[model samples]
Target: MKRLLTILLLTLCVNLSAQTLRKYSNEFMNIGVDAAALGMSNAVTAFSSDVNSGYWNPAGLVNMEDKQLALMHASYFANIANYDYAAFAMPLDHDSAIGISLIRFAVDDILNTTELIDSEGNINYDRISKFSTADYGVTFSYSRRLPIDGFNYGVNAKVIRRVIGKFANSWGFGLDAGVQFESKNNWKFGLMARDITTTFNAWSIDKEEFAKVQDAVEGQNQELPETTELTIPKLQFGIAKKFIYRHDFSILTEVDLNIRFEQNNDLISTSVASINPAFGFEVGYIDMVYLRGGVGNFQNELQIDNSEKIGFQPSIGIGFKYNCIQVDYAFTDIGDQSVALYSNVFSLKIDFDCFR
Candidate 1:
């Protein structure tokens, strides 16, 4: 049983190493934040405002009216994994704003069964241990309105950290930039470039812990795994329009194009790049209640009969705002079209003006 456990662990490590090499490393950062945004299927690049802008498109931070704090939590995979987010943003001056945010995704209390059997060939339950694996990201953002009317730009500096129990850990850094513009007719446009410098994570493995599983297989796990992982750049472009009716009801519609450099299973693929499109809309009454819906993540899936078909994800959410507090809830999927179970996300935002 001990030997089998060791082999399984070794295989998991090897698979993780391969996944890191595939250019989409550190995927936890892409899961997104804010239930309001997720409810719209992450089609908020041009529609984001306030504190949550720190994660979506920092350029929208310039629209913040006052100091604010945001918090969110979601559970996935039958509550085995938890995702949490927190952010704070404040206006620095009439034309500028600054914000900071943190995100964590973790799975806890996993049993370490590789040591279940003692070296003397005796089964010992006391040798078993528990450990957790987690990923963290911290982002610092700054936004400034350009001299041109209705134009704003922002930049982000990110620090990434990952841990796999006591076996390995990594630290990484990256940068992002974004811009937003509004037209006279309530039209909005946005562009965001993520990992513009190509994020890199440098891993350090604990040799003593890893050695226990290094020889689990006869001809595998002989050498240390790759020491570095790289994440390539991706781009998002968005457009939106807002309409008001009778001064009490309003509607907002938006469309976004997500671009990846390499060809893949996206809806529109080519050798140079692939494009995935998202559409979202929100209906609001008296600026206090909102209903949101969206469709995104278009992909090509292979059917059991060897045929291919297109698939997409649909999401919906609602929000209420009164005084200086706002609460939002969303029902969405953490996975692609293949996912059977959906995740429930909730978020809260508080504006500091009331306290002052």
Candidate 2:
């Protein structure tokens, strides 16, 4: 009860302290194409799998061995170049792994035109179409176990870029820090600090002349241009437990309490953070096949706000394992304003156990 109360108090404080909500950043675009299956469904952390361990819980890299490497690619739920991402992790020695990820969100071709007044009112002409704005990010990560027992940590540095025709282009940096722990009984605790830096020169405001026209209409000589900076969330706390049922069957569940703070201010803000509960089980009487299903919230690419929604994202997956190699695939629903789309998540992971 005390733990629960502490959580409630933290949440209340977060909500009351925030003054304004943040707008979108390039990082959100790729987050929509969250692959690694269980990571999306359960708000995954401290859950260790060779492939997604790079993105979800870096500390899980402690589980990697045999000079292992895992790669995953999510095709994205929508075909509109919304959100797509790919990640890979390679382990060396004990408690150490190297990871990399790439993400992109492209706004498909959009007609660029200006209103033209003709004799019969206003007629729009083919003003030539250019690819809509796009955002991309690349991440490199490293993780290791600490000298303390049952403790491990990781960090990631990312390069972010935004492109919007000839109008807006910017480059920036972001950082991530994560920690994880596992008890003898298999309980898990995890925390991650995400996008802790400010990416600068996020947009182009060379259209000062247009602003002047608008200012003339508004009767003001000066107009404050929108801030051309991208804001990213600060923290995410995650927890989960693994239940090994029978000899070969197992179940996993997790939750994440995401918190965001105001840029350049001490204020903070939060929402329920959406609850993503996932379940998985093994198939085949011999435990060679794995089946997975889950639900959770995923960001939208076009929308500037990383709003939270519930009961909308769902996933189903299947996996096959032989020797030390595993191949897995998952189908996910991508919800949107107009129509919800679908995507495929494919992963490959190789594991080795010295004691086995």
Evaluated against the true structure, the overall lDDT of model 2 is 0.56
Can you tell me which runs of candidate 2 are displaced by over 4 Å?
1-23, 27-34, 38-42, 49-51, 66-78, 111-129, 198-201, 204-224, 230-232, 261-287, 298-312, 323-325, 333-344, 347-356
Location of the lowest summed lDDT over 10 successive residues in candidate 2: 263-272
lDDT of 2 by residue, 36-124 (tens): 44324546665654545556656666566644555556544456556556666767667687877777777657443322224455554
lDDT of each: 0.86, 0.56
Worst 10 residues of 1 by lDDT: 14-23
> How much does candidate 2 score in TM-score?
0.67
Best by TM-score: 1
> What's the C-alpha lDDT at position 306 in model 1?
92
As a whole number from 0 to 100, the lDDT of residue 314 in candidate 2 is 65
- Residue 220 shift from truth in candidate 1, angstroms: 5.5
